[model samples]
Target: MIISWWKETKSIKEVFVVFCRVVALLLILIFALVGLVELFVYLGIAQDGFIIQRD
Candidate 1:
């Protein structure tokens, strides 16, 4: 029974690692998209009428 329990525990840890990897990947993708948007605005590629003008 002890050996079986150890196997189960290992399996659970493996599943947890996979879950973490997937979540990390999703977060990285989200950050990459945000960075791309920021780059566009920084480079003046996303001009809109909302840009305020002053005398």
Candidate 2:
């Protein structure tokens, strides 16, 4: 859960800065994870490889 302390913060500029920082970090982390997964698949390291298994 996100901290609600930002709601009590009194400055718009400060809140916007914090919000931007948080969003940027989230996007960077998500991209890094997706990049890693794609790298693994490209290297054929994932179990079952590119062939989808049927139920």
Candidate 3:
């Protein structure tokens, strides 16, 4: 279904442009998520690695 839709609707250039846009958005989202995680860790509200407890 998707293949047929693509074949009928968009040209190669249009498909390439769409693919680039999707990739760019994905990269932006990944960076934003990583930045937020780093910010949380920097604020001491989160931690990295394993935590150990001793009695």
- Clash counts per candidate, in order, are 0, 0, 0
The sequence of per-residue lDDT tens digits that candidate 2 reaches over residues 1-55 is: 1423645655667677778888999999989877776777778897533344435
Per-residue error for 8 in candidate 2, Å, reads 8.6
TM-score of 3: 0.69
TM-score of 2: 0.67
- Models 1 onward score TM values of 0.65, 0.67, 0.69
Query: Which portions of model 3 show Cα errors greater than 4 Å?
Result: 1-9, 49-55
- Please give, for residues 1-53, the per-residue lDDT of candidate 1 as tens digits: 34335445457667676667768999999898777766776788964322332
Off by over 4 Å in 2: 1-9, 47-55
Worst 10 residues of 1 by lDDT: 46-55
Residues 1-55, model 3: lDDT tens digits: 3543665646777667767777899999989877787777778876742132224
Best by lDDT: 2
Error of 3 at 35 (Å): 0.3
Flag the better candidate by lDDT, 1 or 2: 2
Residue 25 of model 2 has an lDDT of 97
